[model samples]
Target chain A: MTTLIAPVIPRSRLQRLRWTFADGGVIARGNLIHLVRNPSAILNLLLYPAVMVLLFGYVFGSAMNVAGGGDYREFLMPGMFAQTMTLGVMTTMIIVTNDAARGVTDRFRSMPISRSGVVLGRACADMVNSVLELAVLLGCGLAVGWSWHRGAGNALTALGLLLLLRFALIWVGIYLGLMLTPESASAAWMPLMPLTMLANTFVSPELMPGWMGAISEWNPLSATVAACRELFGNPGWGGDSWAAAHALPLAVAWPVALTLVFLPLSARRYRRLDR
Target chain B: MERMNSLAVVAEGVRKHYGGAPALDGFDLAVPEGTVCGLLGPNGAGKTTAVRVLTTLLRADAGRAVVAGFDVAARPAEVRYRIGLAGQNAAVDEILTGRENLEMWGRLYHLDAATARRRAGELLDRFGLAADAEKRVKHYSGGMRRRLDLAAAFVLAPSVLFLDEPTTGLDPRNRDEVWQAVRELAASGSTVLMTTQYLFEADQLAHQIAVIDAGRVIADGSPDELKSMVGGDQIDLVVRDAAGLAEAARVLAAAAGRDPVADPGARRLTAPVHDRIGALTEVVRELGERGIAVEDVALRRPTLDEVFLSLTGERTARAEEGGHGEEDRAA
Candidate 1:
């Protein structure tokens, strides 16, 4: 008689660690697979940044030059990296809003999973897409003779700063997405796009008049852009830049601040959603 | 993870009001462990409201509820950990694959990685969704999506499962598949609380049934017991003429102990009698004695629908589509 036997269980530290990380990995893998499967989103991420690069690189590239001492592409490249990463904020908002609108969030609420795992998993997964977007835009800048004179370590630091900003902004976008109904998420937050764009991402604050420049100079996006520039060894405008002062600290603080502000609000909203 | 032979779900004086209209007005239920309790109600009857409160999704304005030994209000997180809910709408994410949805829920339940994958595969196979596990949910058929949604809830082997109108728009075949799954869930020792507008579904699935109407329970009992409450038999006669209708009503009134009801224009007459066989024997003889030809004959115990009508003066499941439906618009 043939005896039935269970498969021998594998035993190893790596295997045990693999088993331990399996839940988070499955969740993360699920989110990544979703992004890969969505063709329209891929097209948007790939083509939109390329189009923006061609358009803005030509439109504003010749008209304005960096005040400090390098080519416009050099100065613009670091800021563009910061801008591209932040555009990922829109993707975060839309995903959250779409999920909430379609009752998917409600489903997660009823499930037995880690309470914050849903949102945290999405945020963590989206960071990869943001980095990819930044990397591509940076490559495009390189093709246009935009070079980072700063060493390899500084380049890594610049990317780190960009991720930090994206992380923080993702929470803000999530908060807005959770707060607004799906139908109105786009219309209600349309204003944030133009407002964030108006900052010192593309142009120098010194080029604009007093009041406009003041607001642009103080903008958090500007701080991120300026930090990237400093890391990249790009020339800086002479004014005592607030971005320079806030840069290093914000890499850590922004994400924490965003979490502190929005996490509780999202939690509260989640708690009362059934009511 | 196993529950003893105690109440799986219990609620006392549960009250919830939405925009000044009471959704669950002092509703109460006691569902034993490992049993399926069908919360039968019309569209505005507060079945969904009660499920929400018990699942810890909605907090009641007043009263108390416990699911799997955890208080829903004071210990919502613990309650959440013990119960699984499949809501009215299919809540699977369109952008994610069926496999992903289940895996995500598994992670939320804090299952380890290999176990989460194993659980996901098992549920996929159980729900007949293994073939479509990798496909985005947006492409799934309505029935398939519902199956996937239901599968996600089973990832944790939850002690108490709440299913709110789990098979609302499915065809007969698909509805039966869902019913079979629900039975399996209960058989696994999970306490199942389900709400449905389908009286036949309630009759087939519920170990104990509660008929909720106008935000309150009008009747509660086993299917057999509830049917017994309304009497053993009913004879409904539809005549060809209005005069015949009245004659039939008169015949039944005299034959039975109470006065029968007549819809003269519709030529319909209904009479409740003591015993199905005895009443039919007496009614036919009485009709022959009155020279009124019997157009039709029926002998059966009261259906859940009839029981609902007897207790609430209207069909219990019909309110979802009628004037009272506006009351559940927000719900």
Candidate 2:
């Protein structure tokens, strides 16, 4: 066999980053194509948003009252968007677990591509699904007369915040996915329900018990939900805590912090899977 | 760029542990360029573990490995460019079509767009997967998927190919297909290191055979070198009746000049023989004379399990060598 060795390996740091994205983009495309072929996986991504919109907006919103007198549906929309973003964890975890279990992760690791690219590819691809899920959730929100009372620019920024939150959770999912088995990862969604609920996605943390409310206010999901509500100009619960007072900054901080912790951990685990 | 080297793969005292006993305890191996080396071992013998280390999927706790002229641990990214691996289980994506799996790997291999597409097409045809190229791997048969797995690793005919138990579960026809494909890869001058349970597969494909037990290479040589060391053909006798097993075992043991390994469940006695025809005739005549009926008899090569028993009990050859060395020193 003629040697395959040569200029393939990246020499410079910038070149390395370029190759990582290029390779990651290839991997991301493959994952997205799988979604197209397997409708069930796509449906799983859609299932959470659809169910949450109905369960919260029509059912629970009918009886609920916002703290400062606004339509409950408007308050519920931002929370639903934030909740859907975090729901990505379940899908990402399951996919990563499957690949890890099936030896797909090992195959990727053995290749000459960038090591972090495999993890990054999965995150990027899941982001595409998140974008689509957000669109559908937005459609449902608009159909139910949940209009954004803010400028279009502010509304788009709110959507960007939700996506940023989703992007960071994607790393968490990748890390956990590498840590768990496929069967257990499938059951992972149950535990995540509490994570989404621990925040202000369903109800204001202000209404919860003392310690629980503090936790909810600090919850990353709560940061995104609170931030989205403010940007969309929906009903904000307006708590006195630092996390409550600065939702936008906390939303950015929480996801960025989680990404910082989990991205390297995921890469390390993938490099030596059995260990 | 440096040209190809003579030894394509080399591992020195590579060790790994998963908590309890280390899987690979000071394992070592060396495969010259462009030769097929078969690694044979029983279950949990660290065959797969060793493959993982050399393939750059796992880093050893100690020691070092060089594959395709780069240290596996220190420069795994560089080493990765020159090797292909088909793990124990088929590692291809099940949801993607067979063609997609290869094309995706091709892209990861740093092939340009047009080249990746063409390479996928060529591999699919070569591996007998062209007809089912469009089908998702989940729908492909075990054999087809395995061929595709081989095809995936063979892209660019990687300088050193590592296949861990490539034919563990396959019918004869499928096994033949894989063997032929491996032969083609070797002919193209690719260094292939394959771990297998079947002695027959090793005989047919491997230029050098390495029998590993408990994570170390206990024996390494050409097929003939191994054959002569492990010894002549084995005479296997299946007694007609379970009651006559003792008598048949006694006969074969006497003829072969060693105790035959008797299987009560199968009513069989297997013993290694120096002279194949003489041992076969003597066992038959003696059994007839003793009125012990014979169900079947055959001359065959040693099974990997039998080889391990003899090799381990050569668990065996090492202690004797140590004794001889001491005696020589004393003299």
Candidate 3:
């Protein structure tokens, strides 16, 4: 007979952190493996933004022009990047809901691992997926004659800001996902389209009516798009509005505020689950 | 001191409620170390709720529970480190392969990479899943998935294990395999606490059984003790001809001093008797004198099923008739 033996608990903070990371990394790998096994979904996500870029660049570009008369494709690329980052809300929501429904979250909750590992692993995997989507969209944009006139450093910063927004929205997806039952998760994606499209993703906010323009300019999506346009040296709508003038700071602030609100909310909801 | 150390799990006056109804109403249990204790109950009896509280998945509104020597409420992390739970739903990932699922659980338990891999392989082989190790769990049969879930729970061989209706949805062959696995686990020194509606399962595996009703332990004893509570041995007889049943019943009543239950279609009569061999002998002689041909007769101890029925039958019948709707509530 094999006797039961107790596991040695980590006593130091550093050791505990290491265990958290080790366990979290394994879970993140599992999420990534799902992405690999289900490539059609990834392909669809990547293709959707590229198709949008082509549709807007060619179909609508002929009649539309920037305030300063620049290439519409270049102007459209930054907005597309921002829109893609925010659209990740749907993917995150669906994945989290699927895990909760499939009993995987319950399995993770029962283990001796760190409680934060489950959400942290999921966030890590979603960020990785975001990066891949960015690469594919960037390539498609280049194929269609969109170029960043700024130097490499600013371009890199633009990409970083885009990913930061994604990181923030990921928490939003997780919170809403955890809050909703699995049956409602599919319906949850319906609101995301209007959320991304009604912003400055396809057209400049200045082109809309006065009230709609003001609201669209203040959108978190708009802030990221406007900031990325400035960083990438792409064409932008000339406006003196407070939001347009402070797009860079608002871009950082929006994501920070969202993280502050949703991260703890999702964590609390997760801990109180099954109550 | 040694005997005190042998107590693996203990709970006192645990209470939990949902929507103003008590799910675990002042429940208490104590299981000694390295032994199997079966919690027997019907639907809505709070067996699953008790498991949830002991496993640290839920907090009791009022009570104290110590599982594997750590207070469940105060030191849930410590208790979690020392116990494994296979819930009513087999909590395995459908997207991952069987081997991957086990390895994933091992990694979550903080095992190193090489050790996790080795343990996953070992568990798959042990659970008869070696051939299907690489197959996705969604592709596996229900029984295979259950075996894998059980294998995941044994990754660390924790001192105390909780199985909530482990074989509820399994076929006879799969149930036998799980029973064998649980027996082997107990023989290998793990203390098991299992909840089962199947009385035979408790009789076959549990060293001690606790019959729970209305969120409380109504009866607690070994299998034989529980059976003895129902009554003495029963004498069953079958006659060759339907017309001979009345004569057999009369002979049984005279010997057993009680009216025997007759099955007219089957031409059989059964009576509860105190003296096992004496009642069999008296009934056989009386039937022979009456010229009634007895096809079969035997004296047998009461089964756990019978004990369960006699204890819970009346209350359940009343509950059904009253239409309380309490049966729909989750445990």
Per-residue lDDT of model 3, residues B51-150, tens digit only: 9899888888998889988898888888888888888878888779999999999888887778888889888887889999999998987778778888
Instruction: Please write out the lDDT profile of model 2 over residues B245-325, one tens digit for every residue.
Output: 887877887889999988899887878888877778887788878888777788777766556667777432222211111
Please give the lDDT score at residue B141 for candidate 1: 83
The list of candidate 3 runs beyond 4 A from truth reads: A1-6, A45-47, A50-75, A207-211, A236-239, A273-275, B1-4, B227-309, B312-331
Q: Could you report the DockQ of all the candidates, in the order they appear?
A: 0.30, 0.52, 0.37
Give the Å shift of residue A256 in candidate 2: 2.4
lDDT tens digits, residue span A1-275, model 1? 11211222226766544544553455567767776888987887678877877777787787877766667777777777877776677777787888776666766676544445566667777887887788778778887787788799998888888888888777777877777766676674577666666677778878778788888877777777877888888765625665546765654566677768877787677666877
Of 1 and 3, the candidate ranking higher by lDDT: 3
Using TM-score as the measure, what is the rank order of every candidate, best first? Answer: 2, 3, 1
Best by TM-score: 2
Stretch of 10 with least lDDT, candidate 1 chain A: A1-10
A43: Cα error in model 3, Å: 3.7
Higher-scoring candidate on lDDT, 1 or 2: 2
What is the alpha-carbon lDDT of model 3 when measured against the actual structure? 0.83
Stretches > 4 Å off in candidate 1: A1-23, A59-75, A101-112, A206-210, A234-256, A263-275, B1-5, B17-23, B43-45, B73-81, B93-122, B130-136, B213-215, B224-331
Superposed by TM-score, candidate 2 places the C-alpha of residue B222 at a distance from the truth, in angstroms, of: 2.5
Using TM-score as the yardstick, the better of models 1 and 3 is: 3
